[model samples]
Target: MQVVTTIAGSDSGGGAGIQADLKTFQELKVFGTSVITALTAQNTLGVSGVMPIEASFVEQQLQALLEDFSISAVKTGMLFSSAIIQTVAQMTANTKVPLIVDPVMIAKGGESLLRQDAIDAIINHLLPVATIVTPNIPEAETLTGKEINTLADIKEVAKLLLQTGVQCVIIKGGHLADRNFAIDYIFFKNGQSFSMQTPRIASKNTHGTGCTFSAAITAFLGSGLPIKEAIIEAKKFIQLAITYDLALGNGHGPTNHFAYQNYKETCEVIIHES
Candidate 1:
């Protein structure tokens, strides 16, 4: 089995962050390991508090995993502090494994997950080493210091991010205003670009969608899928997960991590019967 690691914060709510990443990895049939950079006291409603683990401990965890496990790919989310972000960038600097950086800045409940001061560290250090960086509109705006009210703006930001040395930039357009469709733009290092649009699902149960989407990409990459193919698969997976949302919490619930497998099985059965 392919082993994929998540270096992210722990979501006590089991809806996002490391919890969501591990759940997505397992649902995608990959073995998942994790290094908790921080812990959040949060639930469906909002984040109450956060406690970042020591940078040294985070480094130790990564070292242990790298020494023993044959990690195929890695994904990072919610590195809450500059110390954590710097540590992660340094440790992964030499690894050949694919790294997917989920630039998780704010939460669905309007809480800041990444410290404002740490944003520069991520852009300067982490982005250069990333195989792909997945950032939503707000994150892209924060990273590039530009407004993303239009597709052209997103494209320009992608270009700027590519100049920072990342192999690929995927700016998720889910947060775009006045749109019936959620469009995501992918800009490759080779000057290739494309946009994918899916009808925007109207639901509040999208608490962990970003983390889950990035984790799915990491899992597919660990299983040997190319970056574009992995992203395509991950997009489908998140769409189904959101479509089959569990509606667990009163406020912004979570996307169904198991929905992809269940939907695939259901489709197979229908095909066989027909």
Candidate 2:
């Protein structure tokens, strides 16, 4: 079986961090491993507290995993501190495996997942090694110091992200003003770009959508799919997951991770050259 590792925070609510990532990896038929960077006291409502693990301990966990498992790909989520982000960057710098960096900055309930000081760490350390960096609009704005209000701005932000040394960038355009359709912009350092558009599913159970989407991409990449195909497939997986909502929590609930297995055949994703 293909093995993928998620280095992210642990959400006690089991919706939007390493828990969601593991669930996504399992559903996508990849063996999942994890090194938790922090523990979050959060539910569907909001994040109550976060306790970051020491950077040294986080490194030790990563070292143990690398010594034993041949991780095919690695995805990073909420690295809450600069120390933890730097440690992850250093540990994975030589892995030569596909690295999916999810710039997880804010929660759905408006709580900050990453520290302001750590944003620079991500740009300086993590992005340099990332195979693909996925950032939502707000996170992209924070990373690039530019606001995204139009399609042109989104494209500009994607371009700015490429200068960070990442092989590719996917800016999630879910926060775009257009609610009729949700679009994600994908750009590569090789000067190719594509737009993946889907009819937005109106649902509150989108708590782990970003984590699940990035995890799916990591899983597909580990299974030997080409990068473009991996990203398209990941988008389909997330669309299905969002479509078949489990509606578990009162606030923003988790997507149905298993939805892809059942509804993938019926799902449709549209991609166009940009």
Candidate 3:
């Protein structure tokens, strides 16, 4: 089994964050573990409150996992503070596991997730160490200091973000409100780029899609798929998960994590002795 660790926040709504990550791992057949940085009192409506776990506690969780588990890949979401971001970056730097940094800066409800004070540390430290950073339109704007009006703008931002030392950037169009079309662009750190387009599904059950997308990529990489292939498969899986929507919450609902899962595999992830 490919063991994947998700270092992220917890969503009590059970639609986003670590909850969605574990579900995606199960659907992709990877063994999942997690280190929660914070806890959210959120629902379909929106986040009501946040209780950030101690930064030391977050570090300890990662320490325990790194010392005990054979984690093949890691995905992170919603690091709520500079302390948590710093801790994760330092802890992951010496490890060989592929890391997917989901720069979850904003919520589906138009609220900020990443603190402005922590933005500097994320760019200078955390983002540079990530294997890939998945950011939506607004988050990209925040990181790149440019407006994403066209596909060219999207590619440019991804390229600039790549220069930050992340292996690649996947600029998501999930938050595009134009309602005419939807597209996601992937830019490799090697100066290559690709775009995939799909028609917009008019569904309100869109919460946790980002979490699922990042988690799926982590899971695929854990299964030994190459980065591009892993991203492609993850994209397809997330699309199906969104297509087979489970109408649960009053606000944006959750995607069906098990929608396209039909096969079961025994986990065979192995670790080398250091």
| RMSD for each of the candidates | 4.4, 0.7, 5.9
Q: Which scores higher on lDDT, 1 or 3?
A: 1
Residue-by-residue lDDT tens digits, candidate 3, 203-231: 88989899999999999999999998888
lDDT score, candidate 2, position 199: 96
* Regions of candidate 1 where Cα sits further than 4 Å from its true position: 264-274
Model 3 lDDT, residue 45, Cα: 91
Q: Summarize candidate 2's per-residue lDDT along 1-274 as a digit string, tens digits.
A: 9989999999888888999999998988999999999999999998999999999999999999999999999999999999999999988988999999999999999998899999999999999989999999999999999999998898888888899899999999898888799999999999999999999999999998999999999999999999999999999999998998898978999988988998888888898996
- Count of residue pairs whose backbone atoms collide, per candidate: 0, 0, 3
Worst 10 residues of 1 by lDDT: 265-274
What does candidate 1's lDDT look like per residue over 181-255, in tens digits?
787888999998777777788999999899999999999999999888888888888988888899997899989
Give the C-alpha lDDT of model 2. Answer: 0.93
Find the candidate with the highest TM-score and give its number.
2
Ranking by TM-score: 2, 1, 3
* lDDT of every model, 2 decimals: 0.90, 0.93, 0.85
lDDT, model 1, position 156? 90
Runs off by more than 4 Å, candidate 3: 177-180, 262-274
